[model samples]
Target: MKRRDALKNIGAAIGYSAVIPTAFNLLQSCTSEKEKWTPLFFSVDEAIVIKNLVDLILPKTDKTPGALDVNVPQFIDLYAYNVYVEEKLEEYRLSIDSILKALPIPETGAIDLKYEDYDNLLKKYLKASKEEKQQYISDKNITYEALINLRNQSVWAYKTSKTIGKDVLAYDPIPAVQKGCISVEEATGGKAWSL
Candidate 1:
């Protein structure tokens, strides 16, 4: 090959190599930090609130797992992302923020209260050792009621979303009952319970 042509070809090859890596890096950055639990129509912050709301509303008790464990937050996120109207998502955001703003947060955005701020108040209730959380909730009229409203919206959103067929199906119902049948057929003088 001619020297000039060889140099031109080599330079083109080098340019192409450089372009490829830059392109790959750009793509990688874009692809990283993707929606882990199928982003609901909610923003990143909204999704976190959805999670916290679920944790408070359907708290994990000895009888059953809580909303968080059942992937309800993810379910809510995916629902908001795909099925909820813009107005509804905004409402959920506003409602959550209204409650959060009522809490003692630092000017810098960190919460002012410790993890166990309401020791005998919330955590003890959570731990199943005391019922103070319920009383505190009734007294303060916060978290529980907020969660109830939030959970209703979230669950409705999830049931309406495409993710429901998968997420709800994946959820563990007590006794592992199927579509319309009871798991156990007690023929021994039973009242034919459908619960």
Candidate 2:
């Protein structure tokens, strides 16, 4: 074989060798389970409840997708497991358990609150006075603090997600001009700017 022809064949072989593994990897990733969101910190049941709660907290609207769509529950699970200290982790777990227990769970082990009902329940809590909140904590064993923590986490996860920050919210990939005095409405049409 000619030297040039031999080198050409070798180059083709090297190119194919490099491309084959990457192709297989891409195909494998595509074929893998799409719904692989197991929680590290939460039990399967707890994870399910968290998922339901987060979805309820940030339901899908005409403007943007809900927490479930943004994988906020998964993010919460990871954040609780990885970010929290031992004391905080225990507190989070107990709070989650308390909140789950407060909800009406059916024989199927799922919370029975409809989306609207859950939203109303959240609103009720949000609107409650300090005395009412204390009464609720004493009576129902579900603290407002726990609910607030959950809300904060959900909001953090939702706002920080790439989908929400980059797509749903106002994201400028390349900011050529920086105006400090611009109103939010003037800047990004009332949507919060991406960090």
Query: Where does candidate 2 clash, by residue pair?
Result: none
Give every collision pair in model 1. Answer: 40-77, 40-80, 40-81, 41-80, 41-81
State each model's CA lDDT, in order. Answer: 0.46, 0.68
| Tens digits of lDDT, candidate 2, 134-190 | 887777645466777888878876776667778988999898997899799998999
Candidate 1, poorest ten consecutive residues by summed lDDT: 23-32
Model 1, 58-169: lDDT tens digits are 6667744555555666654443343334575566666566556554545544323444332332343334423655675667544544545665754543333323333333
Q: What is the lDDT of residue 193 in candidate 1?
A: 28
- lDDT over C-alpha atoms for residue 74 of model 1: 62
Find the 10 residues in a row with the least total lDDT in model 2.
25-34
Instruction: Give candidate 1 regions above 4 Å deviation.
Output: 1-40, 107-146, 153-195
Task: Give the per-residue Cα lDDT of candidate 2 at 188.
Answer: 90
